[model samples]
Target: MGFMSGEELVVTLAPVAVYWVYAGIYEALLQHTTVLDRYRLHSRRDEETKNIASRKDVVRGVLLQQAIQVAISVAVLKLEGRGAAAAAGDGRAAQPEPFLVAAARFGVAMLVLDAWQYFMHRLMHSVPCMYRRFHSWHHRVAAPYAYAAQYGHPVDGVLTETLSGAAAYVASGMTPRAAAAFFAFATVKGVDDHCGVAAPWNPIQAAFRNNAAYHDVHHQRGGGRRNFSQPFFVVWDRLLGTHAPYALRQRDGGGLEVRAFKPDPTR
Candidate 1:
C-alpha cells in the first residue's frame, strides 16, 4: 500500500505550523492598538470586548481544531499513498508538470476552492440545524479575532476549509508542488480575514474584494445571517443576494456611509 512520503508530511505540517506561529503573534500585536480602533466597522468595542473569549478558551479551541485538521490531512495523505502503490503495481507513472502550466492550473484551483467555501458557508448558516450543531461554535466569537479564523468545530472545519481545499486541488488539477503553494496562500488568506487590523497596506481587500472588514461585519449577530461567504471573493454573496450592507469610509468627516449589497448580473 502507498504511504505518505516524508516530503508530503512536511508539506502538510509546514503551512499549519507557520500559520499558528505567525498569525498568533500578529493578532496579539493588533489587539491593543488605539488609533487603529477608529477604523473599526462596529464602534461597540467596549461591548464586544466584554464578549471576547478568555485567552485560555481561544487557545484551547484553536489548537483543538488545528489538531483535528492535521489528523484529517494525514489520513488523506495515506490514501494518496495507497493510490500511488496501486498505480505502481499497474505500471502507471506520474509526470512532472511544466512551470507555466502548473501556475495556470493553480489559479483555476483557487476559483474552485473559493466557490466550494461559499456554498458550504452559506449552508452552515442557512440551515438552522447545521448552524446550531456545527457552525455555531465558530460564531461564539460575536466579535472575531485572528486566531478565531481557524477556530471552529471540527465538522465545520472539514466542510469549509478542508473540503474547499481538497476540491480546489482536484478541480484545479494542481501538481503536488502547486498544491503546497495553495496551502500557504490559503493560510495567509484565512489569517488576513481574521487579523482585525485591515491595515491600509493589505492588498487582499482591494485585490480580492473581501477582507477583515467585510468578514468582521459578518461576525455581528444580524450580519452573520446576511454575509455567508468566506476566504476570497464576495461575488458569491453578491450573486445570491445574501450580501450584507457595508460601510464606505468618508475622507473628510471620518464617517461611514452605509451601502447595501446588490446583485451584479455582470458577475
Candidate 2:
C-alpha cells in the first residue's frame, strides 16, 4: 500500500536494470573497441560522427526516460491492486500458469505492444508538429547505438513506451512474474534493435525478422517513412505497405550496412 515492495518492486525495476546492463555491454564492445566491428551494421566511425547527439546526452535522455518508465510502472501496479494484495498477505501459494497458457498470453502481449507502437510511431512521423517537437529527438541519432534506444522526448517515451507497455500488461492479464520477464525481454529487444549489429549468428536477431538491420533502415534518411514497427513483428508494416525491403551489404570499410530498397508503389 505504501511504496512498492516485493514483487511490485521487482516488476517495476527489472526492465530498467536489464536495459542498462545489456546496453552497457554493447557500449563497451562496440563504442570502445573494434572487436565486434565486422558484425556492426554501421561503421564505428559513422556512429561516432553521424549521430547528432553525444553519448553523454544519450545516456542522460535514456536515464530520464527509464525514470519515467519506473514511475509509470509503479503507478500501474498500484492501479492493478498488486501493491495492496501484497500488503494484505495472500497466504495461499501462487501456482504458475500452464506453459501453453503463459505462451499464449505472451503472444497476445507482443501483438498488442507491436500494434500500439506501430500506430503511434507512424502517427508521430505523420504529424508535422509532433515529429518536429517530440519524435525528432529520437531521430537525432541517425546512426543509433544500443544505449540510444530509449533516447527521446519524455512525452514521446510515455506515449510510445510507457502507455503501450502498460496496455500490453493489462490486456494480456499476465502475472507479475510473467510481466517482469516480458518487460525485460522487451528491453533487451529494443537495445538489440539499436545495437547497430546485424550479427546473423545472434539468436534474437535471427528469431525476429524485425532485428537491428530492419530498424537501421528506419533510421536512415530515405527509409524514415517506412518500417515503423519495432522490437517484435513486422506484420503492421507489411500489411500497411510501409515495409521497405532491405539487404545487408558488407561495407567497403569492413562492416555491414543496410541497403534499403524503395517501397513498392503498386502495393
Candidate 3:
C-alpha cells in the first residue's frame, strides 16, 4: 500500500473533521431536549461525585492516543513496504478513482472492527480479573457522556483500541486512507454510545438499540455485566448467547423496562 501526499492528508484529516462535527451536533441536541436530558445516566443523583472532564481534556486525551498510533502505524507501513503521502484534493488523490477504492476498503474495515470489538469486550467482561482490574476505570463514569467514551484504564485502552488497530492493519491489509476513515467512524460510534440519548430509529440507536439499553442498565444497576460489546453491533452477542432479551411486559402504570435475565449464581 503506497500512498501519495494527497492520500496521507485524507487519512489524517478525515477522522478529526468527522468526529468534531459529530460532537458539536450531539452536544447541541443535549442542550435543547428534555427527553435527551432524561437519558443521561448520572443525572443529579451522582452529579456531585462526577468530575465532568472538559471537551478540551477529552480532545487532548484522544490526540495523545492518536499520536502514539500514528507512530506505530508509520512503522508498520514502512515494514510492509506501504508508503503514505498527502493526498491532492482535501487529502484525497488527484483522481477520483483511488478515493472510491479506499472508501470501500474503509467500509470493510469498520465491519471487521465491529467484530473485533465484540470479541474483545466480551472477553473483558467474562474474564473477571481483567474486568475488575483493567476495565473498571471506563465504567466509573456511572453516567457516560460523549467524551467519557475514551476514559479507560491506560493499559486497557491501549490493548483494546490500539492493539486492535494494529491487528486490523495486519488482517485487512488496509491502506492508510481506509484505516483513517475507519478510525473516524469508530470514534464517533464510541461517543454516540455514551451520548446518553435513546432516540428510537436514530441511526446510531438503530445500529445498537439492545446495546445502548444494555449499557444503560449496566449503569443504572450500579454493578453488573452487560453490553460487553462496542462499535455498535450485536451479531456476536446473538451467537454467544449473551444477547439480553429486549422485550418487557408493560407495567399497569406504563413505560417499558428491560426484563432481567436470571443469572446462575453457581458461576
- Provide the lowest-lDDT 10-residue window in model 2: 86-95
Q: Which residue ranges in model 3 land beyond 4 Å of their true spot?
A: 1-6, 31-35, 38-63, 81-107, 209-211, 218-224, 247-267
Candidate 2 per-residue lDDT, tens place, 1-267, comes to 456657888888899899989999988987679888898887767877888889889999999999999998988888987445645765431557789999999999999999999999999999999999999999999998898999999999999999999999999988788889999999999999999888878899999999999999999997779999987999889898999989988889799888999887666
lDDT, residue 40, model 2: 83
lDDT of 3 at 140: 63
| Model 2 stretches astray by more than 4 angstroms | 86-93
Query: Which runs of model 1 end up more than 4 angstroms from their true locations?
Result: 1-3, 31-52, 82-96, 248-267
Would you estimate the TM-scores of all the predictions?
Answer: 0.80, 0.95, 0.71
- Cα-lDDT of candidate 2: 0.89
Question: By summed lDDT, which 10 consecutive residues of candidate 1 come out lowest?
Answer: 250-259
Candidate 3 lDDT at 99 equals 61
lDDT of 1 by residue, 1-267 (tens): 235554466657767887887686765555655555544443445326734566567678777777777777676655555234334543332555677887888778877877898889988988999999998888777665667678777889888888777677667766455567778788888887876555566676667667877787777656666666778777788888777756656423332223445434443
Clash totals, every prediction? 1, 0, 11
State how far residue 52 of model 3 sits from its true place (Å). Answer: 9.4
